[model samples]
Target chain A: MTGPARVPPAAPAASTAPAASTASTAADVDGDVGLHHLRLYVAGQTPKSLAAIANLKKVCEEHLAGRYDIEVIDLMENPKLAAGDQILAIPTLVRRLPAPLKRIIGDLSNTERVLVGLDIRAKAAAP
Target chain B: MPIKPAPFRPSLPKTPTGVAGFDEITMGGLPTGRPSLVCGATGSGKTLFAATFLVNGAVKYGEPGVFMSFEERAEDLAANVASLGYDLEALVAEGRLGIDHVHIARNEIEETGEYDLEGLFVRLGFAVDQIGAKRVVLDTLESLFSSLSDEAVLRAELRRLFSWIKARGLTAIITGEQGEGRFTRHGLEEYVSDCVVLLDNRVQDQVTTRRLRVVKYRGSAHGTNEYPFLINDHGISVLPVTGASLSYSVSDEVMSSGVGGIDAMLGKGGFFRGSSVLLSGLAGTGKTTFAATFADAACTRGERCLFFVFEESAEQICRNARSVGLDLQRHVESGLLRFEAARPSLYGLEMHLARIHRDLDAFRPAVVVVDPISAFRGPDLEVYAALLRMVDLLKSRRITGLFTSLRGDGGLQDAEDQGLSSLMDSWIKLQTVEANGEMNRTLYIIKSRGMSHSNQVREYVMSGTGIGLIEPYIGPGGVLTGSARITQVAREEAMQLHRRQKAERRQQALERRRAALERQIAEMRASLETEEEEAAGWLREEELRELVLKQDREVLASRRSAAE
Candidate 1:
């Protein structure tokens, strides 16, 4: 069951932005190309939860530009949503778009880990 | 003989070996319907761990188990785990478990022909059927190997036995004493089994560390590391060593070292909390003094402490403390400290463990001091296993454990004692150095778990008041002995006092000299002033020099005549 397409489509850099611009031009075309419709599942203001959010914001702004929309979902406030995602491990991140939806577990710091897990670099190669 | 009825074989369920940590290591219990192999060296807790598993299953878990022993009888097994808090009687009475002691006498039971495990299997099957048993334990399968000389028959029967356990869908734990380089003597039984657990009972430097390592688990991701397991009143407690690194956070809190100068030398001014320190030295190197000082500090901080005296009685301990100027009696009387004195040979390794477990449970002390764990060493490896369990137990409670090991003839660098050494979080070697013909006791903290302890051996002296750790002996031929340390410290103290006296004398002489110099300067200035006035008068009289000169001469001659 697919959810609503609240996340915006990838930035239309396919026609304009060159392949060489993947690293440098990623900052210029900063509109939901890299991690959009991202959902952060957490449970209250635990150190892990706070760290997860802080790490995500730092990572997103630095890498994903202002175009990415991060949905902070508190399981304590909405425990029912836990059933939909098979969330055994807490502080899980669900990358909705960039199809074949990847789920990255744990408080996603360790910059290189987040970069590789989110599959953002593959977006620039789309025809 | 014609009227003799067939022998009665009652229904029985397979028995479970209720070893405490063993079950946990197996995960959801040993293959619920298969015979698994438990192999270890002599006194590696192979039989004890296995029997405890069965007894625990029956007595605690309410799952009836049958234990068929080829070695020790029912009473022996019961008595062993009795210290471990497993009451085998209640379980037997409640019709839950059955203990069948099958003594296969080598001389008595003759193997006249090709023997089969069918007779033993029949006996076990009968026991299982009678109790509706869910678990079974066959201890030391080596006994069968010893009984039956043919390896081929033993292998066939063991394989058949494994199949019978599986076919019957009963969980079974079979134990065998480990052979050199082999998991079990009768290989196919343990080989075809679902799990293999290896137990090691090793002793080094008189401290025994019993470790359980899961060599293989077919379908589960068990803790593959050598987990330290303790067999006490409640049975085996496995200290999971796998995920230890993930749990630590660095902190900068300087805890007092219970002694003055020692703390001052430490940049942070103290040891860290949850740090294990070892004070190892020769018999007279004052290792106990260090432990007492630590206990004093812990007790003073309102944190409860446990002192396990191995070599001395509690009263003797108090007396020893008095000699060293540490009054532990007050703390003990005040209930802030608990002093436990027991000979290392007072009980089996497990009994010692049970006492420690019970004491820690009752007192809930923050610090535990095992004064001279080296006393637990024996010709056997059981002591080492017990020591390891004790260490693991302390670590789990996060108790700052201080263990004093008495290093005898061999110095602290003996690799032969690495069993206990590896388990230690921190190691301190105390050496009595003979420095400049005087006995000096120096303490060198060889290792500290999570903090950097002093490497240099500092001189220490205990007087009427308390332990006085002084500056490290600098002018030393090498490390000083105990007698030399005392003499060296006295000489150094005397030298310091002499230096102070000399300094005082120097200061007094300098003060007197300064006062005299000031007086001289004042007088010289006054004389110059008088001379200047006279010169001014002379300059004024220069015009009338002849007249002034004649008057001056007349005045001078009058003054001279008056004086005459």
Candidate 2:
């Protein structure tokens, strides 16, 4: 939780590049690194919510491949859950894993901003 | 069905906000079922106003409300307004109120592409439905602008929200931060066009006063002037004196002016009930004493009195009044008299007016006394305006108002300079006239609107038994008072005594002369009798001589003389 325990063996040296599809299967292993845990908050399955979910999945598949876990929470079904994440806008994406949490609002249409928002590219370039 | 003409309606329907004096200024409160924008600078009581609106609706009007605060949490808001006696938590627990705190941090989130405020809508809708709320407050919705960089989307969403609120027929209040030139930071006044109220906290001469004004009310007639308001333990109360109509019913009743002598000068034995009386005097001229006497008289009659002392504490006033034989403490203890004492510099004049208005509403006293109203140091017009409002407030309730003012310079002209005499129904000026090296108090009824008051100035004297007015002494020197009057009175009495003594002495001499003359007349009569006897004797002797010749002639004469 403090830091990435260890870089996943399947992950490429340059994590900025897309990891192999098999890398995501190793996310359950202990001490696996470069695994992204994201949670998307949505009120209902509106167009914006659907688009955010699709775009978030596409960004995850393209960037980290199988190295991320996306949990979609529908606030309409569970309105009480929205307070826990301090969600004010629909289609909010919260990065819960890798220590310091982060949030990005709106449909994840811009891949570059999403990558930067999740610190994937920064973590790779700096490491 | 036959076609029917629509009934003529003068104004838009209103939802009463239940805020004191506010509804009167708005004519009936805000336009019903529409969003009203309440904008003000920070710490200007915007939150309190909104909360009062919501809480009053729930507790008083049986209307449930939803309060969505973007700045303060539910508990904080509740705690903040608890001083106003609004049990927000109790209301919430009773299902009459719903408080949702929307926490937004600018640094907590990043905007990826496009988003709307549907999540906020969901929360607000849930709260409203949960309470069946007829009122809603979105306090500071403008915070979203700072949290999110997308102003275009936020503005569009706000417009939608307003329409949505209208669609549901919910009376909503949307508070915003005041802008440099506009009414609100984001110009929320533009979206909420039904009504807009602006609150202002102005500091003048290091004193702050809160004022409220209805900037615009579409299709409704509302007061446009800035009405001074107050935020105390009871919450925000607007003093809308201008809105108070002058048509309040008048009473033909007259009440005593406390002291019997002053009442005698009023010609009617008292002042007109529900009328305002001004007691003005120089320093130490017993102005407060007169006011306290009036209060004591009112309380003695089993009527309640409210005394607002700006110069002294209630205890001090009661104690001083006691020295003059006015037992005000007894009245206080009997709950017939109430004292509200505060420093004139404690707040602005408007705040004082609001506070008085609040107290009047609570106490509903039959008489109100503002001792030494001149203690309020401010622009003459401001003080005058405040006093005018106070007079109107008291008159409208048919409460007698006795206001005392300290006359500067102790001149007749100085008393009239305040421009307050015109507002009072009766003006009593107390002057300290220095005569014969002594200062004496004199009372003059400058004016009594409906009564033929005495025009003569009476010497005012305060002894252990309270105030009394002595008949002015118009001697050769003219209008003498104090020891000068006493001396003049004594001198006139001495002159009268001397005149009476001289007349008595003259009568005694004339009686003595009459007695002497009578005695002399008696003596003369006696002498004449003696002479007559001698003559008779001589006649007798001659007769005797004759009798020597004709013996009895003298004897006959003697006999005749003896018979005489």
Best by DockQ: 2
Clashes of each: 46, 4
Candidate 2: regions farther than 4 A off: A1-37, A62-68, B1-11, B415-418, B511-564
- Quick one: best TM-score, which candidate? 2
Q: What level of docking quality does candidate 1 show?
A: incorrect
Tell me the deviation in Å of residue B200 in model 2. 0.4
| Candidate number achieving the greatest lDDT relative to the actual structure | 2
Residue A23 error, candidate 2, Å: 20
lDDT per residue, candidate 1, A1-127, as tens digits? Answer: 1222333333332222242244233434544353255777676776767887888798777776654678777766655454344332356676554443455655776656566667554454454
Clashing pairs in 2: A24-A66, B543-B554, B547-B550, B547-B551
- Residue B279 of model 2 has an lDDT of 90
lDDT of 2 by residue, B172-196 (tens): 9999999999999888988999999
Q: Write the per-residue lDDT of candidate 1 for residues B216-311, one digit (tens) a residue.
A: 767655567776667665666654434333244434454676887766655466666655667788878777877888898999988999999988
Q: What is the lDDT of residue B197 in candidate 1?
A: 80
